[model samples]
Target: MSVSKQADIAPTLRPPPALPADGMVISANFSVGGFSKRWNHCHQLANFLARYASANEDDPERHATLLSTFFNELLEAIYRNHGATGEIKMRFRKKQNHILVEAEVPINEQSAKFYNHAVQLANQPDPMAWYREQLEHDVPDDDAQALGLLELAVVYGSKLSISEPTSGDWLLLAIQFPFTEVEEL
Candidate 1:
């Protein structure tokens, strides 16, 4: 007896699952390197800001404004001593509930050793003192200082650690923030 052969149908493929409704918390870390040369210093700072602008996904005008504000504050802090140059480039990655940012600061002849020294200071429990020392010369106004402190707390303060990666010339600033409900914000 010949049995009737029936074709088996294959199941359709399904798309990958989407991320949870909770939006991501983004972080950006930036730094400058090779600032020994007079012109390179300023260029580096400007470059870093430009990189920040480029990486931002939000409105260009808003991003530019944010960068400009940060740049002005940073410039006021270090212009006399470091004289910004080079570029500020940052790398970011998403963790469980937060994002990590790593920013690089160019090291010039005069600032090379200083940069390393700052890294050492960063290892301490309270690095705010070190950060303040770095900007003592600039003497930012009260409003500026308050804003700078707020930014530092919101951005870098959340970091659990800082390290020099084996693969790249970067001072890794790792931060994590919770993905909370809208009302929580």
Candidate 2:
């Protein structure tokens, strides 16, 4: 092999140092450590959006728009209609480049049906727009049961995966949003 080729193929002994910030959340199902404890997952995610927007640092309106977009999806666990009372553990983690949000929601007999319906909608190619059409033209009272998953899939292009139950009734829905942070010039 040529000398130039050898240099190109050599392994990097030292990986790039992680960010100096030390922030993250620690939950049973989720833990975030990289930025700082002061900054929550939502904050981190919003920052990514702001960076992507290339907006001014102090621009409240830009930040608000981005935050709203992220918050709307984050509120899914709140309006979830379970058959019985159960706890859903939400996990938000900051990876090297992007943020990951997960929800471990319990699946009862009634909620299992909801899960099936949601899975179908989420897997559909045009779920979000289709649901909107249903609301606009056909059914005014469309429940929009799968809006969260649909938006995550359609908007952020997030890779969403649902894990099957292994030990208990809890179903794991994980959303990964890959982002690149803009360096300060």
Clashes of each: 27, 5
Write the residue-wise lDDT of candidate 1 on 1-185 in tens digits.
86655544555454332433333323333333343335345545544654453343324354444444444434432332232454544444434543334445433444433333433444556666645654676644432433342344444444334455454333333323222211243
Candidate 2 ranges with C-alpha deviation above 4 Å: 1-68, 126-132, 139-143, 181-185
Residue-level lDDT of model 2, residues 61-173, one tens digit each, is 54445444654464443235332445656665555554465677666665566666666766678766876675576542223666665666566565566675776466776
User: lDDT value for candidate 1?
Assistant: 0.41
RMSD of 1: 11.5
Candidate topping lDDT: 2
Instruction: Give the distance in Å from residue 77's predicted Cα in candidate 1 to where it truly belongs.
Output: 8.1
Most accurate candidate by TM-score:
2
Residue 136 displacement (Å), model 2: 3.7
lDDT minimum window of 10 residues, candidate 1: 174-183
lDDT of each: 0.41, 0.52
After superposing candidate 1 on the true structure, give the runs of residues whose Cα lies further than 4 Å from its correct spot: 1-87, 126-156, 160-185
